[model samples]
Target: MTEREPDSPVAEPATALGRMTPVDLSHPLEPGMTVWPGHPRFEHELLQCYTRGDASRHHRIALGEHTGTHLDAPVRFVPGGADIARTPLRALTGRAAVLRGPAGDTEVTPAALAEFEAAYGPVRPGDFALVDCGWAGRWNTSASLEPWPYVSVELAAALLEREVRMFAVDTPSPDPSDSRACPVHRLLLGADALIGENFTHIDRLTG
Candidate 1:
């Protein structure tokens, strides 16, 4: 875990906020961070530095739109679909229902989701349905390679049926790494629902 900056202010714990402490689900952007193969690698170039006689320190960052933690707008796969700027903020933020997947690099199927709902409760409409498969733990490592866990197309349909505002996962993509057709992406984005990928620290939400 990354330590907080010494000068940064401390945030209140969950107990202080009625058991609702905000959890940061984003990964830190940096050079050489793990990204899908064939995608642009993250880069950071020092632009100005006070030690170099410049007024301030700054950097020039270069990365793909899908770098690190990111959201997929309808335009990503849908023709003439709404772009990120047009996507409503309400759709991305809401009461999230975190579904914890079983251990290993397996497909998240409808049966697994139904089992989760049976244990907890049905995923309500307009909720951000985050599926945590623990893949974020492999970030920046060789284990982040292809064949990572992914959501099945059937589960995508189930989420769409539930009318979830967003279907998010910790892996690089909702579809399998070797997928050519990207069935899950098409199924969700085609319906105007957002998909958030590469989210880290999703397990913290349960805590």
Candidate 2:
């Protein structure tokens, strides 16, 4: 038998010799789907259907770029920043951790992140640190449209210091609803980290 080289690529098994299951993290799109306030709602129209005696079916959809469970590119806030197409894949995936918080918390504070790190482990560089405030359950409700948990500026700065590649939350925006300045968005975007907003089912993430 030949010895395997140390530098050779080894296939890492994702499961223990069993069928792997795929978890869906994206929200399905449909007509009248929930969206940010003032943003255009999604609409689905059947261009051609089997019932119409057509050979195939087709649909026409219209929605905003920042619609449900979407990633926000730097260009969203930064002038001349990278667009959605220009965003790197590594920035969106790879090692990620969800920092859980108490229900009804208005903002993710630096202390909460520290506590999470102490319980779990320190977040390494180039990792995606997500804030799970149990707000995803409020999707499509009036409370979701109102002010919900968001990332504080101090927390954004802390995450920057941790060198996180992305900051994700389960809310419409990382900043509060009433705030006009939106410092959290500017700070994270200017630091070259992407943002994921309006995520659903984040609480279901487990080891």
Each candidate's lDDT (Cα)? 0.86, 0.81
User: Per-residue lDDT of 45-96 in model 2, one digit per residue for the tens?
Assistant: 8999888999999999899898888887789889998887987665666767
| Candidate No. with top TM-score | 2
Which residue pairs overlap in candidate 1's backbone? none
Candidate 2: lDDT over CA atoms? 0.81
The residue pairs that clash in candidate 2, if any, are none
What is the overall TM-score of model 1 with all chains considered together? Answer: 0.86
> Which portions of model 2 miss their true places by more than 4 Å?
1-21
User: Would you give me the overall lDDT of model 1?
Assistant: 0.86
Worst 10-residue lDDT window, candidate 1: 12-21
